[model samples]
Target: MDPALSLDSRVATLSLAGMALAWSVGLTILSIAATGAWEPRVWAVALLATATIVVARETAPLRAPFTAQAHLVVHVLACTAYLLYTNGSEGSAASRWLPWIPIALSLLIVAMCRYRPPREILGAGLLSTSAIALATMPLVAAPMPLHGAPGGALVLTAVLPVMTASVAAACYSRILVANSERWKAQAGYSSAALEPALLSDIERVMYRERVNALSGEAFPFLRRVLDADSISAADRDTARDIAARIRSAMVHEVDRTWLQAAVDSGPTGVHAPVVDDPDACAPMMSGTQRAALRTLISSLGASPRLDRFTISIRATDGTCRGEVWARFRAPYRPPRRRRNADLAVLRVAFSEVTVSTPADQLIVRFSFDHA
Candidate 1:
């Protein structure tokens, strides 16, 4: 799976866990403070325990599927159980509206649709709507008096939010999908303007290094050959051989492309080998992407905690995929602010970027088109 998608799943899982924790805590406090039947309080405690267990299991270090269906099932059941217990137990207007709490909670599920597939999102919406409808059936049949309002009206009031929230979720999911496509399109168009500047900067740096190399090695060798006045045939041949070798070296140095030079000069402890197969040639990344990759490499090299790092890139079918693996000398948690800043830049440059921390290892995987 794409690393970006995995990160998104983790984020969604954590968010759901946090929500469940908050809901459980709040429910427990409310049960303690409010004068309610012992049965409802017991049920709330049981539900809270279940929620805690689910969260612990889901948020474990090991990767596991965090399904939208599971989320809807747990929360909907908890909310329904609470509503069933609370309804008609109190005469306050608030008590009559207790059924709406579950619908409101559904919004959290809706918000998470960003991380889910369209079909999953649609399924969750339908499940939530059905759960809300089924949970409120008792109230609809019993016709609970709320300031003399009809039971149907009261049911509609609760149902409307669920319907509205479902529509909103669909719209939000569509927007997220559209924005992702738009960004890729923008990156493709913008790459043309950006590539030259990146290439020029890289060339300038390489040129300076080449100049230094010529002054230190090639020029001195040639000067020695020129200074020798009395030279035998053997000596002249040796000089000619040295001159040819020097010329060849200079030509090779000059012929090295900007990308090759940059890759060769990458920070210590990072290895990017040249893959000879045509299918394995690195894709032509946009200037922005190259810049982002350079920045990320620099940041990783500068980190005192990182002991070793390796990155590999390969291209196939017009797409370039890269993987970065870093090992820490000790357990290290990267500074969130700096890491996020780098990732944000990378996310803009690449179509997808994923970062994973497992035990003492950090893995970053990303892919982008040739553009």
Candidate 2:
């Protein structure tokens, strides 16, 4: 899977988990208001159901099918309980509509469709239909005559909308899955088609840079060697040394503009510290990774108390490791929320990142594969 798409899935999963938690809280509040008493069992069930769904969402990548199945089962059971309780209670004909509330909440299944298979969506729809039918069975069997309306009318009125929505959602799920697959196929094709052009452009740039560098370093020496009437042994040795140096420099040539920009743009009050490894070449980083590093530097610069900061980077064997260390004039403490948000952005780009604060110095270390 594409890393961007995988990150999006994680974000969606977290959003759904948050929605489930909010729904559970709302249900609990409604129950308490309607009954004028706290129901521990209801609260326990609600929390457990929400927590189970959240855990399943968090672990969905491990076993998507099983997670979807578990989510469907939990939703069905929870909605069934709500339906049964509301239907069994004594209330006006208007109360027949109350059971549909839980059924409506089941629409969250639509969101799940994005990540679940067609079979799972179908199974969920079927199970939901059955559960709704079973919940309304009492009304079907009892045939209560209220406000000149038949019990069958009440059951149908309540069930039809839920069933229709479930079916529509199922169909929509298929469409969504098809569209997603198509989009992914097109993305793959586009990437494949552009690879050669991108590589050609990179090769051209590197070639140009190398040519410029060679001219700048060796042109003077070459001109002198040619201008001299008779080149001495020392001059020949000097030419050889110059050639060796140029080759060595070319082997490690890399752009250092990003590093300079990062340092120069440090917070207004903070002293701009030098790169830890002044001679080390900048690692080739993706746009996403560079953006992440930019954000990290900005965050470090944001703290008013930070008086000094240093950035260190090392690349070896197709991997690059970087560290940022900041020192504050006063006893500085980082805010957890802000720190976490910054780290989240880094983690999206880098393979691994860690932060530590020992005393007043804040240190962040991250690594990524340059290859």
Candidate 3:
């Protein structure tokens, strides 16, 4: 979507989906009231509820990679089936409000699109609405010749308003995302500057990032000095400052261990589960422990399905304790075989290893001497 979705943002998404469910339910009740048919109206309510549950799971802090797409499938099935089932011979009169039914269901499609990617929004909306429209077309025109019959062709007409609105709204969102990316790219000094991938997970520090900042200042200062007629006292002071900072930065980099570099920026830029090591415990782990943790962190980070990650290293008594928590973007646990190798590394690397996976969340606790 807009790319910067934190867990807090999911609350807002769930709220909107909840409201859509409420409104959809209201429509079901109204359809029943209008036609006095109990069973079909009941089915409509049930379908909407089922769709709502799927939506909740998808919008949760954790869900499968297919969860978002599952919304499209479940909703299309529920909404289309409800609209088609009701607008038939048995309940033609009751479904007189069928036009509004399609629109209401379509609103659900639009509502859930917030959690989906911008590029896919329009296609999801169009395809879902089209499925509803097509399903109704075959039966709508021939629903036992009831008065003011809701015809097949008329179903498309009924859905047109929502369809148009969804398209416009989806396009607007796409444009907003495109513009946001453009603005970020323009403002940044390099690709790394604009993209979060460039950020190092370890202490949120990167030598390259620091060098970029340093160079930003150093290069400009050098150019100014070269263009000037003569070097002033301040110019000489500025040059001395840059030289001192450069030397200090080099010395600091030289002192850092290999583990620091490994965690700071390795493959996949050691992606994005928030690293919360406030105790500064990583640098204290033994060399082998660091290697094991590094491998596991990298492997987990490499998965596109990664949702949330937290690594906490604490110092207590004579030893240092470490915990790594990871949650994937799947509704259930990913296959064990995929992680079996990384697990083996963990078992071999640490003296005391404990691992548990509850739901999709993985927690691994280990201890190593502070080196």
Tens-digit per-residue lDDT, 1-371, candidate 1: 11233444555655655665566556555644665555765665466456545544533323223445455555655565556554424443444244425543554555355554555566656665666666566655554454556667766766666667667767766777777889989988898789999899989987887677567756776687689776577766866876787678779776655556676777776644342323433436777777877777777777777777776777867777888777777767655445654665676567667778887777878898765
After superposition, candidate 1 runs with Cα above 4 Å error = 1-97, 110-123, 142-151, 169-184, 196-296, 304-371
Cα lDDT listed for each candidate: 0.61, 0.62, 0.63
Model 3, position 252, has a per-residue lDDT of 66
Candidate order by lDDT, decreasing, is 3, 2, 1
TM-score of decoy 3: 0.50
For model 3, what is the alpha-carbon lDDT of residue 265?
Answer: 54
TM-score each candidate.
0.53, 0.52, 0.50
Better of 1 and 2 by TM-score: 1
The C-alpha RMSD in Å for every predicted model, in order, reads: 7.7, 8.1, 16.1
Best by the TM-score measure: 1
Candidate 1's TM-score: 0.53
lDDT of 3 at 293: 81
